[model samples]
Target: MKLGISSASVTERYGYDKGFELIKKSGFDAVDVGLEQYGVESDPFKLYHRSEDEFCTFFDTIRKLAEKWELEISQTHGRCNTYSMDKEHNAYVRWVSERDLKATSLLGAPACVIHAIVSGRFPEHYQNLEFMISKNAEMYGDLAPFAEKNNVKIAIETSGRAMVNGREIKGCFSDAPVFQKMFEAVDTRCKTVCVDTGHTNEAVPFGAPKVQELIRLLGKEITILHLHDNNGTYDQHLPPIRPSRGTVEWCEVFETLDEIGYSGVYNFELNLIQFGGVMDEAVRFLGKYLRYFIENKGKLM
Candidate 1:
């Protein structure tokens, strides 16, 4: 597994070019393009309003820059909010997602990550786990053909539990059984799961099927990951390493990956707060983390 990082980690502080430069200098082999927010002057991160011509021009430039820096587009992430009551916002999110599918395809990325819209407070459709599964199936079913046509897969990510609007809301894809149901419900060859470690830690805390069990349940269907560490309480998105930093079981994770024969890029989804926006610090952390991963991978087997 090759090491990769997300552009979202630095794009908020640095422009696209400078961020790509930092990622290259940080020793990463690939980058997950952040389509999460809009940066000034049509950044790839915020690509909601760009016309086809504009998008093509931007993509071409980024492609050239990636080639120059010797980096590959590992995957792309799009924003979605299925729980929102606002029709306009929901429509906008869907529109951007459609555009993101094409944008990811244009970059020649094999897959794009799509978030599961979980419930906020007051129990919306998310109150019914079955409804949530069916909702995701209906939504992704509509996008599967588009994904196949673009030759890009959609990776449905697992989410963390959260308290919103004075109510407790469980994550939609938290449990392995529920996750399997949602994945199976989609019934599309173009869609797969993107397991988020931090979220998994939140879901199965002191439970029957831990992270490794969750992986075992989703074996072969997981094609990507949003690897990160958390305090076992929230989705902190911290760098994966020592136990003091977070509670992720790195050794067990690696062993399970080996068991599943996972050969996809090992990508980290760290938030900038952990490294204080210092590129050198980020590089150092990744170097140590990758060394640990490499030394201990498949040891249990």
Candidate 2:
């Protein structure tokens, strides 16, 4: 497994190019860039503008930087919450997602991770999930060719909220079966799973062993992984450490990945604040752990 950092952690300080540079200089193999808010200090939810040329330019610059730093642009994350609202917002979300998919292709990244809509807006939770999944597939159907041309995949991440009888439910989809159904509905090889460890923990009422189960179920279908830890109640965005009652076992997670021959980057999606203001230290911490696992990966297998 390779080590990577998600740009969301340092978006407050670094722009796309600098963020990739810092991640590379900090000894990470790759970086996950949030394409929607490139070079902006505002949240994607607060921004209403859409410029295709500007987006393309931002990705071009990122590609150049990635080449310069010898770092892989492992994945691209579109704006979260963009797809959770009305028809217009959902259209915008699809437009932006397609743009990112094209950009991901140009940058040589394999996948783009996106969030599912919340269920409360609709009458029922599973119904809403089914609708959102179908809508996403329909909206982005044209981009599959671009994905095919660019050799990239679109990864739908399991979200943290569910809807029950028009009330907001606070958990991810009950299991991998939901994801399997979505994938089957979409009926595209480009669609895959991006598992967020923190979100998986948040979805469970107790321990997050379901995360391992999901990986096992999805197996080779999992194209990307957001590797961060949480203390069960909230998304702590902590770096991988020893697992506790609430969190997942770091070593076991790696072991399972090894068993499945998952070659994707284990992108660290932790918050920089939790690292005590030292980005290098955070990178080193993750690198040490990942190196230990990679070196022992064969033995574990």
Give the clashing residue pairs of candidate 2, or none. none
For residues 1-301, write the lDDT of model 2, one tens digit per residue: 5778887666456665676666777678888876666423464632324465665665677788788989888898865654444778666666666666777876778888866444444444455566756755664464567666667887878655454675544543535676666666665667778888887776666322456777777788787888777776676777655444346565566777877879888787777766656865666566666556546742334
> What does the lDDT read for residue 202 in candidate 2?
67
In order, candidate lDDTs are 0.74, 0.67
Best by TM-score: 1
lDDT of 1 by residue, 209-283 (tens): 567778888999988888888888777887765536587777788888889988888888877655664665666
lDDT of 1: 0.74
Give each model a TM-score: 0.88, 0.80
lDDT of 1 at 166: 72
